[model samples]
Target chain A: MNSTIARLTATGLLRGWRGLLLALLPFVMLALALLVRMAFGIDPEITSGLLDTFNLDTVVPLIALIVGTGAIATEIDDGAIVYLLTKPVARGRIIVTKLLVAITVTLLFAAVPTLIAAIVVTGAAGTVTWAYTVAATVSGIVYCAVFLLLGVLSRRAVIIGLMYVMLWEMLVTGLVDGARALSIQHWGQSIAAELAPDAITASLSLPVATTLAVLVTGMAAWFATQRLRSLTLAGDS
Target chain B: MTSIHIDRVSKWFGHVVAVNDVSMTIGPGITGLLGPNGAGKTTLLSMMAGFAAPSAGTVTLDGDPTWRNEQIYRHIGMVPEREAMYDFLTGAKFVLANAELHGLSDPGAAAKAAIDTVDMQAAADRPIATYSKGMRQRMKMAAALVHRPSVLLLDEPFNGMDPRQRMHLMELLRQMGSDGRTVLFSSHILEEVEQLASHIEVMVAGRHAASGDFRAIRRLMTDRPHRYLLRSDDDRRLAAALVSDDSVVSVEVDSEEEALHVQTSDFGRFTVRLPRLAADHGIRLYDVTPADESLESVFGYLVQS
Candidate 1:
């Protein structure tokens, strides 16, 4: 992966109000955690529910959508991608570099905040904090790669990504057992199940979820590179 | 010297053929791609730049196929017609990013040199969102030049520039051409092409209409039958006198408009002869307007011919 491309992507991400929005999400999550600790009195049950429902299932995918798609979609929309495209570097390298930057941003903006929130909500529960952090980090990386590829492949990437996160993962997976097995959230929660006490539901086996996450991330990244190689610059007719 | 060879290239969007079987070799010099809007100039340039693949045939830079070939960009620079650049970045940062993307060792130095080349150093610190159209155009030029590619392709480079900026850019392009860099810029304005380009490739309705030295193209343009709408105090008398001249092919008197529709075979002689003959015949020539002087008509004449 090219460092120059990553540098360009990183700088571009921080240059506008979009950067401010990304910075704000984590603080908002921390505020919610502090409010919950004060009002709800540091209950482990409440902490697990908040971490599972809000942090892992909702906030992680939302931040991934913003950072992942923002990394490449803005460039494509502005036509600034021409500079990167017309270079001697391999197209896959560019895709991988941008994905790396997107994942880094997701980790900073999404996973770190969820970890801090976990610690705040459950005082002295380092395992809970670490488990949820790992889950959010891994899922955020996979989501970022998948959605970043979506950004390259489609103009309506955000809409499609939101549908997958909200409808397919949250709605359908919550209802159907088979659909849950296909969800990124469930895969992440299955890993989380291993770290959490037996009180939380054991969603899936650890090996299955870990293997699926690896496969999805790898396939998404590979597909994105292929899509980018053939990405057509629409003619101004 | 770097050259772009478009060999039997045809690009189509479904059933609509944008460029139809176009074949041209652009060598080391400044060549103008002259065509009306929607005449496939952008499509042709896109294919050459390797952004879009030709539906048929090939676009190559020095023998390497341009489509799906990222390495071709090492020797080619492109200034696209679109206005959507990275508006958030300062001009210097934008050019510097372009330099770095090209893998230049000293990106800062290359960016500075490119900014200086386009005389954009004065506004390089401002965000590109704040730049005027001319400043943005020059910045785009600087970005394209940051890598110092041998082949430079600009699509409608002077679309919105003021006169002074236009002249400055024309001078820069001329210098680049003299330095043996293959520079190709597209323009619909004949004067723009006539003033700068030593060679030109004219496209009309998705076909190569003509290609050669500027003078040859200029002659092809001027040598068409000249049509004039003449309003005179004595339209009938003017027509009567003008019809007898061998240079005048046909003269019709339209009573409703009280004007003379004159078609002349010799443009040079008819222009001077029309007014002088009216003066000698004691007729007041109120107006002598070239009927078909717009670019569309000129291009249409070329297509028809």
Candidate 2:
């Protein structure tokens, strides 16, 4: 709600080594896409393999973890959040502002790069670029909200988020078909499937995925704001 | 005027009580929250700063609840005890960000003013990561003051500062208090609290031990029966002479240690009288030390009283 707070949060996020890490994910994805384009000559199967296996599976979650958790966790860790908390601004406004910053970072680092990388791998034959790009963008926003809330809730947010992203999403979801229905990546892929005619495979229907995505994102954001309302300053104990 | 009123507030973490049924009213002026380390000073300050919620009762500023109330920050500025801050930004930029967070119209001017107030204008452009402990403390002060809040809560503000920086900060706090701003700073150093605060709230073991002027607390600290270890050339002579004096309550000659353990009710009279008596009798005094001069003992006495 406060533009200045959003600006500050974004500026802080992009200030140091953290910004470099954020930029690294997209660069790696792009580099892989360029290598695939040169080596395999724009094959749909190759693009699908790279996009489904790496971009959707790996890059999206990692970027989300970094950007989402970095938005608020760093401030809370260093006790710099007291500056923001000791203001007349609403707690919800603070969360929303940080969430906006996290979303911007995630989109730039994950979504946009996925779009460009999709173009490089698929050329113009399929809607893989647009499909994965939308999926990444939507998933990126949800990850940012969920992880930003996690950052506010726990000091060990990064560790827990990495577990959720790596173990829960990749390992559990891959083994169990029902687990895919509960995955943010799957919901995102479902939306992406609707975009591309034959470029991607989705586990869920469009209506169900859309409803779940909206519901999860909304709920995560709401929960984050609620958690922040009672967020006790560390070192008080 | 904003005044923080802590009414029978107690805060516990699990089974450990950090602050227990403590109550105090902090109004306009510099009030020192003095206690030894881990005496719930930070916990009490956190509750007052609206960072921690009390388990029971209330902490309010001008009748408005402090806990979970973001609006109370409009009149309250806090300098937390922790050393960590946004190390990436320049001191001026950090202060500006804080000002902007407070929705200040002219953040630049406010930041500049705060930096100037802390006398850090010369180093405002440098990154806080490169700052010394004293400089970081000053920058933190500048950030806290950027919004010109009425109530300033500082926890261990003089922790790492040298004597010169301490004097400067003390003067600044005194000036703020004189200007009718409610300034509360916590410290364990008795001299530091005595030098600045006209009013002090003493806490020991999570309870409010004493609350009043520094002189009154000093009286309470001194009025208790003081035990002194006296090592003289002739312990028997000193002990024999001291026991007969009206000021001395009891005297025991520790033959093994070659010292006299004396308990005196009138601290002021006993100190002068004992040394004078020893001198008059030609007794060479080797050592005269207060047996229990630690802040903990003083605080314990206050708590017991």
| Predicted model with the maximum lDDT | 2
TM-score of 2: 0.95
lDDT over C-alpha atoms for residue B123 of model 2: 92
Cα deviation of A71 in candidate 2 (Å)? 0.1
Q: Where in model 2 is the C-alpha error above 4 Å? A: A234-237, B232-238, B253-259, B276-285
Over the stretch B1-305, how does candidate 2's per-residue lDDT look in tens digits? 77999999999989999999998999999999999988999989888888888999999999999888888887988998888877878898889988988888999999999999999999999988999999999898898889898999999999989999999999999988988999999999999999999899999999999999899889989999999998988898888889889999999989888888999999999988987999889999999999999999999999999
Candidate 1 on A158-223: residue-level lDDT in tens?
Answer: 999999999998899778888977888778778877887453454779899899988988888898
Docking class of 1: medium
Off by over 4 Å in 1: A197-204, B231-242, B251-260, B276-287
Residues B1-305 of candidate 1 have per-residue lDDT tens digits of 99999999888889898899899999999999999988888888888888888899989999999888889989999898778787878999889988988889999999999999999988999999999888899999999988999999999999989999999999999989999999999888889999999899988778888888999778878989989999988888888899888899999888998898999999999987887899889999899899998887788887777
Return the DockQ of model 1.
Answer: 0.62
How far residue B76's Cα lies from its native spot in candidate 2, in Å, is 0.9
Specify the poorest-scoring 10-residue window by lDDT in model 1 chain B.
B296-305
Residue B12's C-alpha lDDT in candidate 2? Answer: 91
